[model samples]
Each structure stands twice: as structure tokens, then as C-alpha cells.
Target: MSHPIIRVAIADDHPVIRMGIEAAIDEIPTLSCIGAVGDSSALVALLEQSACDVVVTDYAMPGGAFGDGLQLLDHLRTHFPDLRLIVMTGLDQPAMIQALHASGIDHILSKADDTSHVPAAIAAAWANRRYLSPSITQLLPARGAPRAIAALSPREHEVLVLFVSGLSVNEIATRLDRRKQTISTQKTAGMAKLGIDKDADLFKFASELGLRTARPDTE
Candidate 1:
């Protein structure tokens, strides 16, 4: 008996990236590229019209009726709770990674890293397992002094992580679905608990705590 083919969709703003992912999917006998879209709106439209086993998408695609980044992810999670999503992006900051995980994305791939693992990521997602790029795994906070991250409440920790990841107060507020003032208060409280008084100090503290550098290496 033949196993069912896994119908996959690719969503990214760049045509080249979409094509590359499609080609990768084509190489796998059990997987088929059912849709390739440039934005979240198109992705949603395609999903409404067909069944897809997995969706591989960019994290920061702009110019769509449904928005992008965390918003797009949130929309998909809310509307299509059963769809498996694999986010492939250059945004590998720890806070963003944490947020994506919290948002129910089980697979993440780094655009700056090699694409050889794309097939593996898809396979893992198809099997309902989590897959994080090695580059992303390295960015997670190392096991160390428990008090470093334990001092803050869950919301506070989230705020601090996003802040340290370089998201502005308003942007984080928008992403977390909280008011600007609430996010500001959480930032202040979290920083106070961590004894971080300045932006530079916060970055330094986060670095020491094992958050990866956000800068991509230049070739």
C-alpha cells in the first residue's frame, strides 16, 4: 500500500526563495508542493481552497491583507489549528524564537544557514515533531544560574526577551496583544528584577545569558 503524499505549501515574499523551497519539496517523493505564495493573504486563500499537510513560510513577509510576522502566524494558528507550520527566516533572535514556539510553530529554519536541512525539517513536521535549526538551538539560553531568568514572571520574561531582541516597545505590545503601557510596565519590572538599567546593559546581560547575537555574518 502506498502512503499518502504530504501536500505542502510555501509562502515567502521572494520568488527565488519560494522556488528554492518548491524545488526542495519536489525532491522528496512523499511530499508535493501544492501552493507557492508570496504573502500571507495568498497563503490563506490557497489554504481555504485546498488541504495542505504543512506550510513553510517566511516570518517577516510584508504587504499582505492579513499582515505579517507574528500577526500572520497568529491568524493561521487561530483559523487553522490543525495545520503544521514551519517558519524559515533570518530572524533568529532568542526572543522571537521563543515567541514563535509559544505561538505553536513546531519547526523553524534559519535562512542564513544551509538549506540542506529543509527536507529534514519538513519530515519532522510531518511526523508531528519539533525541529529547530542548529543555529537557533545555539541561541537558546544556556543552563546556568537559575536566578538569571527565574527572577521575572512569565509575562515579564517575555517582555524582556522581546526587548533584548531589539523590538521596540510598541512593536512588542502589538505582537503580544497588549497595550503599549502594559508592555512598558512589564519591561520596567523585568529590567528592575534583572538589575538591567540601560539598553546597552540589557543587551550585554542578555548576551551573557546566552541569547544569540542578532547580526548575520557577512560573507
Candidate 2:
């Protein structure tokens, strides 16, 4: 029997991020930034003093214990169970994402996401919908079917390892002492057979297959 506007608060260490989000929030007629705090203590203090429809919290502060966001969420739930939470961070791993999803974080957005997507995630948080960015969602393991085990030639698997580790065709060629065109053809064939397009996806799939030794791409 009541129309409730979405009350929003922000807790992030960066002033620039807060400003950017506030600037974006201004364009949305349905939402407003009623409070913005920096760090965990400020965040907890504000949430205790005021009732917010949603809290846009960051993963860490200048001095936060690990899993600080989860701790804060647990605290918020104890006091204000009805408050909608939208946890956001730059961390983009399936295990971390799965943990956040299971922990009552309704909406998760990656900082690497394009600016236009922020508003949609916020709106979904307000609507109590599961908001997943295309980039982040794609990292989630497939549903309903186990991946087919490809019996790649040992060389094919070896090349895929370097390829996923961010080696360009030329780099892979140099690293493996092979011709560039040959390595390129192999990578292309692997991509087609694996149904993967980008190197990032290739890395994720390789990691899922229990190959987790990407050296962070020296080249």
C-alpha cells in the first residue's frame, strides 16, 4: 500500500569511484544517494544510524580484515535483515563469485564492466533480482552437462596452455620453437573445437580442466 523509493548508500575507498557512481545515480530518477561512506567503520556506523533500501559496498577498505565485506553483510543482516545489498568488487573468479552468490549478495558487478552497465545492476538490486554482468556470468561453469573430454594431442594441449597464458601466436611460436603460422593454426583449431572465442575464456576452461599454472603473461 506504499510506493517506496530506493534509498542508496555507498561505501568505497576511492573518492573518484564514489563521485562516478553518484554522477551516474543522478540520471536515474528512481534512485538517490542518501549517504556515502568510506571504509568499514564508516559503513557500519551509517547503516546502524539510518535505514537504507540498499547498500553499495566495496570489497575492502584502507584497513580491513580479509572477507571484510562478508563480515559487514553478516552484521547488516543481524540488524537490518530487510535491507537489500549489492556487493561489488574488482575480484572476478568463479569461486569468489560463487561464494558471494551463496552469501546473500543479490547483485554482483565487476569494476571492469563498462560504465553503462552499473545502473542496470543497481536497478536489479532494487528490484531484488539476480544481476550478473555478461563478462562475470560467462565465467560461471556451464549447467546440465559435463564438458566433453577432448583427447587433444600432447602438443595441442601444450600449445593451449601457452595460448591461455596470454602468449600471442608469435610468442607461442618463439617459446615452443615452432613456426608462427603453425602455432596460429593450432590455436585456431583448438578454439573451434573448444567452443571458446577469447583467450580469457580459454584460460578459464583450462583452469576448470585442472591446469592452473598461468604465469601472468610475461610477454
Instruction: Put down candidate 2 lDDT per residue, 1-219, tens digits, no spaces.
Output: 654677788888888888777777778777778888778778777777877888877765556432355666787778788877776677655544554565556577777786566678778877778887776676545551233223344566667877766678899899888899888887767565555567765664465443344433322
Candidate 1 colliding pairs: none
Clash numbers, per candidate = 0, 0
**Deviating ranges (above 4 Å) for candidate 2:** 1-3, 62-67, 144-219
Looking at model 1, residue 199 earns an lDDT score of: 72
RMSD of model 1, in Å?
A: 10.7
Per-residue error for 68 in candidate 1, Å, reads: 1.4
Lowest lDDT 10-residue stretch of candidate 2:
144-153
Error of 1 at 63 (Å): 0.6
Q: What's the lDDT for candidate 2?
A: 0.67
Q: What overall lDDT goes with each candidate model?
A: 0.77, 0.67
Model 1, stretches more than 4 Å misplaced? 142-219
